[model samples]
Target chain A: MMTDLPLDQVRTLLAVVDEGTFDAAAAALHVTPSAISQRVKALEQRTGRVLLLRTKPVRPTESGEVLVRLARQVARLEHDAQAELGLSGEGEPTRVSVAVNADSLATWFLQVLTRVPEEFRLCFELRREDEDHTAALLREGTVMAAVTSSPDPVPGCSVRSLGRMRYLAVAAPKFAARHLGGPVARTLTEVPVVVFDRRDDFQDGFVRGLTRGRAGASALRHYVPTSEGFVEAVAAGLGWGLVPEPQADPLLGDGRLVGIAPGRRVDVPLYWQQWKLDSPALVQVAETVTATAAEALRP
Target chain B: MMTDLPLDQVRTLLAVVDEGTFDAAAAALHVTPSAISQRVKALEQRTGRVLLLRTKPVRPTESGEVLVRLARQVARLEHDAQAELGLSGEGEPTRVSVAVNADSLATWFLQVLTRVPEEFRLCFELRREDEDHTAALLREGTVMAAVTSSPDPVPGCSVRSLGRMRYLAVAAPKFAARHLGGPVARTLTEVPVVVFDRRDDFQDGFVRGLTRGRAGASALRHYVPTSEGFVEAVAAGLGWGLVPEPQADPLLGDGRLVGIAPGRRVDVPLYWQQWKLDSPALVQVAETVTATAAEALRP
Candidate 1:
């Protein structure tokens, strides 16, 4: 079934998706816009699927995403072959991109790079997104690998458990004393809370568990989007939040922050997903990242 | 022409796109999947255009994006009307979502939140994206407003100049003495640089300017995705990179960081863009954000 798909059309589909317009894709692929259009049309006819939405910045239909993923895998294989064959262009560093969550990027991801041998001569591009959405990049063929919360493999990728990342509900000592002096569940609903963003529901989920799903975190919440700054905001006595365990440790020990629910915490299971290809660079990254996660994260 | 598009069908179409699947959209809209399919099909028939690509997660066609924008405008108007007539649901906070860059989020953006009047009962949802891409959220209706690098307004939105964010080429004193003790242009390519991520080119641009466009910053760069952390990494002597002027001031004043290039700097002009509607909540937020940016950023 896969053999029926033409390589040029698949690569053209990826170019159009990446460049966002037929004209731009043509410029990127060094062809005419009409050529780009005809190629896409031919590919759609061949696949018997509507491949694109043709938006201002073009969006791939689900069918198009499949082809885009295939294009990336092919590109990865070609790059690896070039590298192994000593045919890589002079001084052209091999570039690898990975999508990672903010918490992991802030906490322990750098150590992975340190472990990479200088001999690898690789350049890394990191995309910071939420753990739940990191896999979307892999699905889109934007990143070769991702540190994602989903255990499910993005088709063509293999998944391995990286263990659970624990989070603690904590607040500045002064803030807890001032605003959280009452009953845990009810008081949480009344007091101000800090969240990573509107999409962040960890604190609300924690509150719901305590209140039997009767209430949510306060509507009067502070949206601090960065992981490091989120902890800083909580420690600065702005609001209480569910802070990642490692980030909260020093603050908790130094009394800058106090655990409100010492017995309650959230453990988000993380997984490392990468393309199932025989590429040395990708293999080294996976091994290094997995090894670091094992040491830094709780199983 | 506007009357031709039924409000229910329009809303349902938005639901389908947002929810990603027909079944999910039906569940979200509290209707059967068959009903959702019928509404969308009817809408497409009336418009004489294919509105969606029926894939796993359906994508809105270009024409569909137009209707989605219309649906969002209608929703905003309805919410504003309810608020004005004092018919808003009990304890319903006026929610305002804004997309901003990391530098703004870490620095002056929070000040806008602090200035929101308590009487307004506003809930802010800040979406942190790159400044160049934040306007896409506005265009997609994911955010009501955005701080963008481009002055061009998204359709159905207005734009205002927010002034320039200056970035200085900086490094730790020890790093500068150790690695950058030679000619500025050529040495910059040899020394490691710190960048916010792969998309970051400020350091490369700085180096290119010095070298008459013959070179770029080192490929041996450290990728730090957070603004604050990027500065900290540079100050820790990991690499030399461009630091936002405001964030770099204290470090420069304290001698933790040194200017790599005395005169060379990058000034990224920013602008605020928002929906062109007369909602009091939106108006208040715009005024607050604009006033704060005027004070905090350079014109």
Candidate 2:
């Protein structure tokens, strides 16, 4: 059957994904739970695809995530557009769409905001995603720009190299002494490790690189997804894993965390990609990000 | 003052710049010209910058583009979100955003529409732009995806090989005879050529490659910006140009145009870049385009 998706219903899907359940989405949207359920069901029927994995807090199916991301991006653009057009309601704020990795979001990506030109009032709607996957957000038109690993330009976007982010394998001195049991490399696989999530693979990649692809990190993995928490867990001697240079540096200095591999480090190059439109705000952002990366990342 | 630019206003600003006038943008947006004017003024005040260089069809100042892009991206996400949410208006169809080069649009890009999944039931909002510059649309989130010349992926998107698009140096038999009276290398500089616009450098680049940077193509140029018109202009003996294989094929077969540089040809590599969204619709599109390109473009 011929069907068209309304803007508000899409926004509702985003609300459900973000809020985690129909009840919460209903409360957020100021609609009833029944309305939320019906809306989601309608979406599924229209696309003939299952959108949500109905669990405790409703998690979006892959299709649902596409829509969730789409919703957030729409809200953000609508806000920016309204402001550009000087159309604003007293209570409504402009939403800016940005794609950032979960690590950056939990770390210093927010600092990018502190640098925004304050004279031009703008609100931000941030999309937390894997940096490796953030560019997909741009392709789906989910965000205006993104922080990504690829140096190649996205369709219709210009690219600037941001530089590499270095990571070190470290753990608290006490924990290392207990779990690592002296020679670090020899016993790493035997010791338990902390992983950010099932998607976490840095530890495995590092081990593979070290062992020439013979092994992966310990299978006894503790899933701690938050950046701050992951760092803390490693600092608490939970497991040895990759940590950003800056975070590892202070801890190394204070003798809190000891590096298993002191000098050898892996550097993941980062790049800033944005649409080629000559938008004043995006340019300002690209400039700021470029400047920041110059200082914070490897040359 | 602390100002937040709304997404819709930013979008309207882009529409004005793209359409080249407030009234045209109004028509495109289904709003009155007064509303368009007011929106732009608000954006200017909020940014505390003169964003638009107001003229017959106003142009955005360097500052204005940032907001415009943000708006377009939001619109794209809105489209995607609406599709996922299945919110339909009585007859309004969901629009899909794509960034395509003028040459491709003039040739086979439209054919992609026939291959789309019938369930998508979408409208096409194709942005006419240069291939070299199409990636900018992805970065700005103006379109969900684009066909670009860069081999690299955009910041937050993935890249797939589409293959090289070959361009042949051809001229109308009359134009070639007049302009290329002597050895082409020696006389091409004085010969007039057809170009897309002021920024177009295809013919000049072709000349430079042949001449080892000693000289550029004709200083005298006839700007026939449209691809079909550009080819027609050349066939009508206006000047020589680098024509895409498809457009130049029929003309060459019929003897309307002749190749100037027999062995010298330019093969520009094209790629498909899109947001890394985990959506089936986008993935399907990318696959279809890649498969098509595999057959159509040079390996």
Candidate 3:
């Protein structure tokens, strides 16, 4: 059934989705608007499913996402084949897209890029998302690889454990004296808190774990989205938060930030997930990432 | 005509868009799916425009974005009014959503949070976006305020200058000695370069400004999405890039990075743009952001 899907029609569907409008897609493909419309209609008839929502900027349906993922994967394979055959233009580097979490990117992930061999001649397109959501990017075919917190692989993707990233509940010494002098768990539920983003529930999860699920972090919270900024916000006494060990270590040593929870820590196990393709670039990245994570993250 | 638009219907449209489906919206609002559908249909009929695309995860149309922004602004005003009248529940802090660029958030924006008076009792929902695209969040009603590079205001929003953020072309001393030995402009077009993200054209724009638009930064580029990571990558000899003055200053003072282009700097004038509502919380944040930018940015 998959073999029956027309490649040109599938490619056209991807182009329309990428360009957002039929007219825009026509301009991009150097085809007439009528031709673009006919191709899309033919593809829809072939699949017996409506693929795109014909809005100002067209959006894909769930069925459409499946095809889009296929189209991207096919394109990636074609690019790899071209590079291997020396058919790609001279000096045109192969681009590898990956979705990574803020913490890893800020800490050990950048080191991966520095470690890649110069012979690879690869250009990296990184999409920074929360660790919990990076797998979604992989499922959507928006990226070829991801550093995700989930151990389970997205369908058609293989996963490997990248070890755990430990976080400490920390606050400035002055903040501890001012607001957190009481029981640590009880005080955390009332004092101001710092979070990575609205989607971040780490601090709340920490508080809930400490208080037997009776409470969460404070209602008065500051959202500092960047990993570096989150650590800085906590150290500057804006609010208490769970800071990753590598980022928190320097501040802890300098007495700029102190551990509020004496022995409690959260360890988030990360995994490297990638499409089950045999592309050399993806293979190289996966190897470098796994090697780096082994050294940077706790076993 | 504007007053004729039903508030419930507008709010329903926002709910459907946020929840991404009629059933989800129904569950979120504690209403039946039929009621959610009827309300959304009514909104479209009243507005004489399709407000949503009925995809698996629904998307708002361009006209829908305008109404969503309106709904968010109205919600903001009502929250402020309730807080002022002391009708808000005990300890329910006002949440102010603001969109800001990464560089500002990392360098000086966190300071704004620390400076806000404790009595404001605010919970911040920050969306970190590129400065060039931050105003789009305002237009989509995703944020009440934004620190944007555009001086031109989004409709229904007022704008104020936040001064200029100057950037310096910097690379590690070792990177400079290796890849950047030739004339700065010509060499920059070919060397490995670092960028904040795909949307980031600052480095290329700097190169174009120097070379009279004949060239862009480099074909071989590494994307380090975080502002701190970007600077760190440059310092780690990954690539040359334009680093914000506040971030670059310390690195330069410490000799970790050297300026590649002497006397050539890019000054991006940032602006504070927010809805023209009389919300005290928004007003306070705007004032603090402006004050901090004044001290942290170049005139």
Worst 10 residues of 2 chain B by lDDT: B88-97
DockQ of each: 0.32, 0.01, 0.67
- RMSD after CA superposition, every candidate: 4.7, 28.3, 2.9
Query: Residue-wise lDDT of candidate 3 within A1-299, one digit each (tens)?
Result: 87999988888888988888999989999999999999889989999999998876997776787787888889989988998898998557878888998898888898888889978888888878876567556766778888888888887799999999999999999999999878898998999999988788889999999999999998989887888888888898988999889999999999999999998999999999899998889999999999999999999
Cα lDDT of model 2 by residue, B233-265, tens digit = 678775688999999999999999999988989
Ranking by DockQ: 3, 1, 2
TM-score against native, each model: 0.80, 0.40, 0.91
Provide chain B TM-scores across all predictions: 0.96, 0.73, 0.95
For model 1, the docking class works out as acceptable
Candidate with top TM-score is 3
State which docking tier applies to candidate 2.
incorrect
| lDDT (Cα, tens digit) per residue for candidate 1, span A222-262 | 77788877887788776799988999999989899999986
The residue pairs that clash in candidate 1, if any, are none
- Span of 10 residues, lowest total lDDT, candidate 3 chain A: A131-140
Each prediction's whole-model lDDT (CA): 0.85, 0.72, 0.88
For model 1, the superposed segments whose C-alpha errors exceed 4 Å read A1-90, A139-141, A155-161, A173-175, A189-192, A197-199, A213-223, A232-239, A253-256, A276-280, B1-90, B172-181, B189-201, B212-224, B232-239, B253-256
Task: Report residue B128 deviation for candidate 1 (angstroms).
Answer: 1.6
Name the regions of candidate 3 deviating beyond 4 angstroms.
Answer: A1-6, A21-67, A85-87, A131-133, B1-75, B85-87, B131-133
Structural RMSD, model 1: 4.7
